[model samples]
Target: MIDGSPLVPHIWFNQSVHFRKGSIMVLKTLQASRVLVVAYPGAADNEAYRKVIGNLEGRTVQEETCKTATQGEVLRMREKYEHSPPDLILGIGGGQVMDSAKMLRVLLENPGKSFANILEGPLAQRSIAYVAVPTTPSTGSEANGTAVIKGSDGVKVPYVTRLMVPDVAILDPSFLSTFSSDQIFTFMGDTFGHAYETMVSKLTNPLIQSIARSIIDLLKLASAELRQTPADARGLDKLMQAGYLGGLATGSVFVGVCHALAHSLEQQKGVAHSSAVLSLTPRCLSWHAETTKDPIYSHLLSEFESIGLQSRVSPDVLAGVDLLLLARQALADPAMKTSPIRMKEQEMMGLINWILKK
Candidate 1:
């Protein structure tokens, strides 16, 4: 265990047993054999997914594959096509696909309504059973309940709340085998961010602390294996599991600056979510140290050293380099909120200047 506890996040790990083993637990959960599988066209073209799709055959099912779907389109699919609130909405891609299912389920639950209303104010609605099957690891859509909806003007708007966590999320290690580490990796930054941010949050508790430690420890082990041998399946599995743990922690406490910067850029500037997050994380970590170093920096330093990043970046330089990276993220980010740490605008600009090197 990284920090000797599972309390950082609340997850039904037992769901994995049922998902992988094809156990009857699924049957018990779904009274109706009918299922709705949603994926982007890209996933539909994937040969690797054929078997899973085939298994769901012979039942009442509706498959939707599209480039993009608006909230209105999702609602119309349900009301017009009579595809009522599905017994289960299975999302088979990254965040966009996952958000589609969540919105679909939400619309179905409240007939004649759509995300427009949900965005207008607080939602009285709760979660309907949505199962998220992640093809890529970084988005963590399976673990969180917030969604970004593109408005009529082609701008994304966010609806943040706790109602977005999927009822079930299935992470298959085999999926990682198909990905080139250089193509798209769930970086170890989340391992540190989730733990450190949660620790720094006013809501930190003994349970959250325990979960954070476990994720950090596991991430260190996984990162080490990847460093030694990039294609290690055993190593990939640990990395995937660590990502899962980070998701659980982030969903509970929510990420701090690294993610906040990503959100600002993606929503306001239309930056690609993965690229935006990857770009901003280091800076936030640097600024974070200036603001918080107690148990937070202590824990972060230990995790980074364990993963072999600390030696490359001495403790003396971590804050400087990380801040430089994060500042570029903010400048490129179309938006951001002043964190609880209260870094001034001038200070933030200074940090940005450091990140935007020639």
Candidate 2:
């Protein structure tokens, strides 16, 4: 019901997003007595996360951390808390941990149903509140409702529903200070891809595009500031804001052909998600420019080049993979449907070949 009208395009936030310095104060506002905290290993040792625990000292708290966000892990977590579900599920990590938190929340609320069953059918409203505190600024999992969990077969399955959106998002930029310069770029590269795709997404309207543009601009400023002063608080704060806006925009309109191709590479070669995304995004931009013959696409590519991201993948990663099959898989993703250009199978294959070569 929030900005759900069909007449205009507006970014809808189903959660309350807080951009603040401390993470503990947000916990006081939640109406939860029992809390299950799913966090990254060693996260609870940090000051912010520790303060969160301190705030809820008298409340029941069970903390769990998993290395991978997979369906089996979620199912196991589900069984552990099935009889006594927590009133709030607090996710405290990067994308995978946050994703695990979302899946755990969903499965706990709906017992006796498989993940696939819930993904395929209508889901009931969630009773347990979900609060997300992102330890990393990359995925923007806090602002969004989609959880991409790897299945048993290793394919990343995306479960998209408004029901999965966190009830609150606590973005504390201090967590970003610990990231190395190289790590910062990797995360910012992911953010750039999100903003770039959202700007040109077929599902985008004026409102979404405006926010996307702001994200890109803020990233540019933050990148320069971080380069001059590593881990500058002001720079990281701006980056955090950009990350949140990137999530809001991409979560609304969804990513496009770049993500589609990146997903294919990740599936076939086990390339890291952000690495594949950074590697293929510029090539996707080039393809869009050539195919659409649009000046805006060309300009966007120039702006993206200014970000100075280095692709982390080696050339041999695609060695023996079938370009045609890869193209088909990339095209098959639902993300491709939101692309500005609808490429044919052959055309997509050509782009893949070009990407690997260049």
Q: Please provide TM-scores, in order, for all candidate models, with all chains considered together.
A: 0.74, 0.91
| Candidate 2 C-alpha lDDT tens digits along 225-320 | 988999988778888888888878877888888888778877888777776777677777887787779887788777777766644424554677
Model 2, runs deviating above 4 Å:
1-10, 45-47, 310-322
- The local distance difference test score of model 1 is 0.57
Clashing pairs in 2: none
- Between which residue pairs do clashes occur in model 1? 2-213, 2-214, 3-213, 3-214, 145-164, 145-165, 283-322, 283-326, 324-355
Prediction 1 TM-score vs. true: 0.74
Q: By TM-score, who's the top model here?
A: 2
